[model samples]
Target: MTTDDPATDRTDREDFPDWLRQLERDIRPGPAVRLRIWCRRRSRRLMGAVGVLLVLALVAGAAAYGSGHLRRPGPAAHPAAGPAATASPTAAPGPFAGTPAAGWPAGAAGIVLPAAHRTGDFSTAQVSAGLAQVRAALLTARLDRAFMAGRSPDPLLRHFAPAARASVRKEYATETIATYATRLAPDARLAPDPPRVSGRITYQATRDNDGARKLAVTTNFVWVYGFRDPGARSGYSVVLLHDTVVWHLPYPDDVAAASRGLWLHRTSSYGWGLDCGTIHQGLVRPGGLDPAAAPFPEDPEALYDPDHPIAVPTHC
Candidate 1:
């Protein structure tokens, strides 16, 4: 059976092994059906990866939304300031008919506030004008002898909000300002140079009664008073006065509307000290007398006067 029949013997030997031929057949794609089957196997893994990414993206979006980073452009917040209680929307073309100051908005516990509005960035242009108005008011209140000689201090009342006008009126009635006024007699006058910004002041957000966002501003007034002390041993007494005046400004959304809502906000409970400074007794007299050294509260700029205190008595 193992004879020398070359052709038959070669076929029996098999040049390509059975296993190698079968491997080639398996490697080659047979049809579209087989290719579809192969793709379906990997598609599950690919789909699972996409699904995981989608879940992560959804989570991130939810977090951003909760944190207010992804807030949508929605209707603006409408805050009903105290005036709304008295104001009738039907009476006016708008909610607040004439102007914001018509009734003068109030906050909780009768805290006087500007009209209900947004807060501001307080740029130089916006803040400078406000600064000027307040500065002039401050000068008139504590200084300006000629203006207050016999005239009513009511002129200064225009600058203060209606709610606080009475309280501050009492403050000017006290003897502190009176004493300061008399000391600068014989053509002595108190002069205020332009106000210069002193130091760091914080800007914090607040919610108005109507839920409108507002900004609280901390401001320092470095008031330098130039006076002629005709009676003093020294020639001229320059008083370096400092006080922290706090107010609020409305936030502006549009560039055109910037600072339109800007104003000062103050409540007796939340306002800063009217006078907080290193007491320099006399400008001409260096290392001058200390106001605290006086047996009585003798500081001219003190909020409380020893001889004449607030209408409602407060222990100094």
Candidate 2:
């Protein structure tokens, strides 16, 4: 027993030294040092994450600011602040401005030619007198060379306004009367009778700024010519032609209905033919010619009537 006791005591003492050394090492702070190192590493990682989040927040704020500025309202947002709020400029009165007085018609028809055959202020008889002067002028040109030698002496020529006179002068000056006569057949010559004429004249009665009456007339004529050239071996030849004349008078309504009638029907294309009838139906209506009345017919085969010869000399 004594021998075994001694062996056990020695073994126990040896084990105790190793165990004490291990305990001392554990309590010395090595565990605490490892834990402190781990905490420092984790703190650095968290700080890095916070820094990234702050950078993202700054970028997002800049984008939002730019977007807001771009969406601002423009000048059109307030209409009252725009050009619409300004007053519009007015236009000046025209030459023919102002409403006509009471009882005056709306257009020229009422102001120029009120009645079917009457003009402004002038009686039908007075208009006829003026028109007779025009017819005389036309007839004189055919019958007498002296009348055609210079400007027409008829009072009707004086009635024309300056513009109308200029126009007539220009037209007549440029016209080749010699050429026109030469185009006729060698046997052609002036007829013995005057041309039969018919038609209407339209006149304008406008007052100028100085209160002077101004007149503008349009005449249409249907002329029938009976050729009486002695050289014609085929007997008497007849032809028809049309003419239109426009003139101005110093006074209003100084044109006659008969003259106007003669002017309108004077042109061969518009006189005593189907075309003339068509024009009459269209032009002479409620305000023009009597629609109920029949138009004069034209015989396609007949050249002229023995009783009603209307031809005049063309050459001097």
Q: Report, for every candidate in turn, its global Cα lDDT versus the true structure.
A: 0.41, 0.39
lDDT of 1 at 199: 25
- Candidate 1 residue 234 Cα shift, in angstroms, is 4.5
lDDT of 1 by residue, 195-234 (tens): 1122224445666676555556554433334344455444
Give one digit per residue, the lDDT tens place, for model 2 in 1-316: 2345888657644544455558756664354664564556578787888899989988888888888778976556534554445667786332112211112222212112223345665457656655654555444433243333334434223433334444333334333221111112223343444434344456655554666454445544444434443443443343443445543344534434322222211221222211222232221100122465554254422322222323332211
Error of 2 at 290 (Å): 38
TM-score of the candidate numbered 2?
Answer: 0.31
* Candidate 2, residue 200: how far the Cα is off, in Å: 4.1
Q: Model 2 Cα RMSD, Å?
A: 26.0
TM-score of candidate 1 to 2 decimals: 0.33
